[model samples]
Target chain A: MTTTLRTRQRFAKAGVLTGLVIGGLFAALPVLWMLSTSLKSNGEVFQNPPQLITESFSFDAYAEILGNGAQLRFFLNSYIVAFAVTVLTLLVAILAGYAFSRFTFPGQKTINAVIVSVQAVPPITLVIPYFGLVVALGLYNTYPGLILTHMVFTLPYAIIMITAYLNTLPKELDESVKVDGGTSWTALWRILVPISVPGLIAVGVYTFMISWNEYLFALTLTRTDDMRTVPIGIQLLMGQHSYEWNQMMAMSILGSIPVLVLFLLFQRRFIGGLTAGAVKA
Target chain B: MTSTTAPDTTAPTQEPVTPDRPRTTLTRRLSPFGYLSPTIVLIVVLMVIPIVMVISYSFRDNVIVQENSVFAGLANYTTVLTDPNFLAALKNTAIFITVSTVAHLILGLAFAMMLNTQLLGGVTKAIFRIVYILPWLFTIAVIAVIWRLLLDPSGVVNYVLQTLGLLQEGVNWLSDPGKALWAVTFVNIWSGYPFFMISLLAGLQGIPNDLYEAAAVDGANPVQRFLNVTLPQLRPVIISMAVLDLIWTSQQFALIWMLTGGGPLNVTEVLSTFTYKQAFSEYEFATASAAAVIVLLLTMVLAFFYVRLQKER
Candidate 1:
């Protein structure tokens, strides 16, 4: 009986191990396939067997596109816009989070509720008005316009996540800093900011991703190829006459690297951000 | 007594080391404002202004270039309600939300439960967790492109199914009206379930083990214990997750736009795509804005119930 029980346990363990292997392969397939296709020659993509790997790996796609100058401009544009949005969001969200979490003020609750209300509104709802406003402000084809529009989506998210995190921190540190002859501003810069670096980093990544991956506005607002983000640029690659599958796959993989690196670098805090976004307390 | 009194007077010669309170009433009141000012200004410019503009624009008549202001009171709203495209988008959005949310929840719960088993512990499990989460970090563009590749007529999926004799020929997964919506839902669920798994796992970890032991003592079966104990404990987490997923998936545009572009006669068009097509291709900003407003209202309704539920908990 004891032998049978032991054998049964072994069988279960083996089954689980096999399941994990299968799951891991399944999870990795699309990303791996992406990289594989990006390396393959254009003609090999539509083959019946589906070239999982090809002997004639070529950099022609990347080389040809990079030579065109459009891709380079798009990459530079995306970075500038994304970094600007990230920095701006972090600065604003950190201050607001500190205030909402620690301070007593008139209309505080109402302000927080308003922030919550912003999250409920679908971003698509604002696109038309934003188009009108962007044109009115004469920012129709500029970085500031795109950054400002992206902020509408990212700011509320940043505020909510940062505030939730800040509430978890003790208030005694702020009081102590104030008692030590520090002004509120000093307390904010010296005390709160350093302590909240993880949360700030998380918000920065979120904001950057929003700005970087934005499509509808990017596609509509930016007419010049130099102003297009990677998403829009890649979309344009799917033209009327023909679609370049290999080239599009290559661009998609390239476009994904920055955020993937950020996530890997700050996996722990990123998980916290994800949880905060999902399960608001 | 004399020594104590003398020391008290001597100590008073020194000023107090620190002050705990604000120096002035204004400073006291404005401290929070000082911290929140940047955020307040940003939100006002970015969020409030745009939303107000939307509301105002919905009242005007700007089906094309913004030339006229007829102040068509409720006409846009009436048209949006009565339009077949808008209604279809609404129905499709609702269906996508329901199907994706339910599928993710079930699969997520199963994955979490399985991972929580005592045998699947330590470094190996951590590796699995990390692998599972890799998909969530991918951009929507990447997801759309990769799924499009897999769902194409001569894609890897069809190739495998054919080899296995499950399919007689390659299926036009994206272009086919019957399959496009389900294909979108499938991609969404696949992209979403990992996050749910991790969340549910976290929630499960918080549940006490003694309840299971008590149920065992009562001779309750595994399924009975799960239904009676686990389900009730997980109710809040599940509801919150479902609400957030609904909003996120309902607003999904990039993936659908890239894959099918609401193709095969707009059968796959959700609100976001519908709005995009109307405003841009069709050149009807007022009607598009009306459709977007309906999406906001529906999502807000979902969000309201979730918020109230969270408050109750």
Candidate 2:
């Protein structure tokens, strides 16, 4: 009996280890190969036996991407657009979240429902009309066009998350200011916003990530190399270079750095918040 | 006013009228709308108006490009619904989303379970967790690029498979009509599963230790315990994730766009690509608008169920 139990324990351990290794490889090997290829010379990309690490590994691809004015412009546009989207989303969402959490507004449920359902509106649905509107308004191929449209995507999630976060904090935190003859607006800035920094951080990080990674709008709204975000820039690079494999890999890595760094910094908060809808119940 | 369904503990149902201060009551009354104004305006211009415009556009002929657009009634819808390519896109989208969601759920649950094992150290699990989430970290564009390289005819993936006797020759993954849909779907699964894994990992941790202990005392083996306890405990999260995944996976365009361009005789063409081609490539905005509206309505039906499910819980 003891021998059987011991054997079962051994098998379980082996099973777990095997599963972990295979899963780790599945998730990591392609990413690893991308990094390896970025380091390799473009000519070596299709060598009969692909090596994860090449002796010819150097920073040529990275240098090429960083040194180019057009490529660097993609990074700049991404930062400008994503940063604008994050700040604006946070401000708008915070105020809306405040209202949802604090007051019993007349159309609160309806408005909230509208915001929630807004997420279900596929981007493809909006792109056509947006093309008409943006062109009509002469905002086509501009930052304002991209920024405004991306907010439609970012704001709903941010509002829901911030509202959920604020709901966790007792109303008394803000109400105390109101009792002291201060307005709710002042109380929000002074008390609620300050205390809600962590939640706001999580929301801001997510907003930035969404805007940073956004493709469809950025692709449609912008018409120039200087205006294109990194994702679109990567696609352009694929077309322009055709088969400059190392350069393409390098661009992808560079493009991914901001969100990757942000994820690494706040994985726990971001993941916890994202899956809260699933897990909180 | 129906704060009954809010589910947040600290959210009070209504604002208490502090009778002492008229100013406070006034501020409370007016400020909610004031705070909400920006959101309202943005949502109106950006979401509501655009949706209205799209619906209206769907009824017209040559709306965007032509100056004298005509009211075509159901003509645009008929054109879209009758188009064989649109029908192909609809079928492909269903398969793509269903396969992707199921694969995501399975892979997510397995990884979550493995990572949640009691025998492993937290540090070890954390490293593996990072590895597991690596794919989800990259943009869909980067994912598209990386996979394209890997699935290249003479690429490392083929090299490994051929050497392992899995395939006799390098398969042209993206360009091949038979394999294009599955190749793109596989990439979709790869980039998508980490989110489900994260959610499921959190769900797994939330399952109580005492429940498992009780099951063990009741002579339940691991599999039996998992079936009776773990699965039941995780049902809510699983359903929620499944519905959410279905909604998202169906809407996936960027990955399919960047990877295959819905090409090789449109084998990988999904609704989003079909609509995009109609508007941008083919310049048939009215038909694209009809297709887009169909996609929207399909998403809403799924979302309606998701919201209802959440309310039920």
For model 2, the superposed segments whose C-alpha errors exceed 4 Å read: A1-7, A278-281, B1-24
* Full-model lDDT for every candidate: 0.79, 0.90
Residue B15 local lDDT, model 1 = 37
Q: How accurate is candidate 2 locally (lDDT)?
A: 0.90
lDDT of 1: 0.79
Best by DockQ: 2
TM-score for candidate 1, please give it.
0.92
Worst 10 residues of 2 chain B by lDDT: B2-11
**Candidates' DockQ values?**
0.46, 0.60
Q: Model 1 over residues A7-115: C-alpha lDDT tens digits?
A: 9888888887787677667677887888888888888887878878887788766665667677778788999989998988887787788778766678998998888
lDDT of 2 at B1: 23
Off by over 4 Å in 1: A65-68, B1-23, B217-221
Interface RMSD of each: 7.9, 5.7
Candidate 2 contains a number of clashing pairs equal to 0
Q: Per-residue alpha-carbon lDDT of model 2 for A30-58, expressed as tens digits?
A: 99999999999998899977787777989
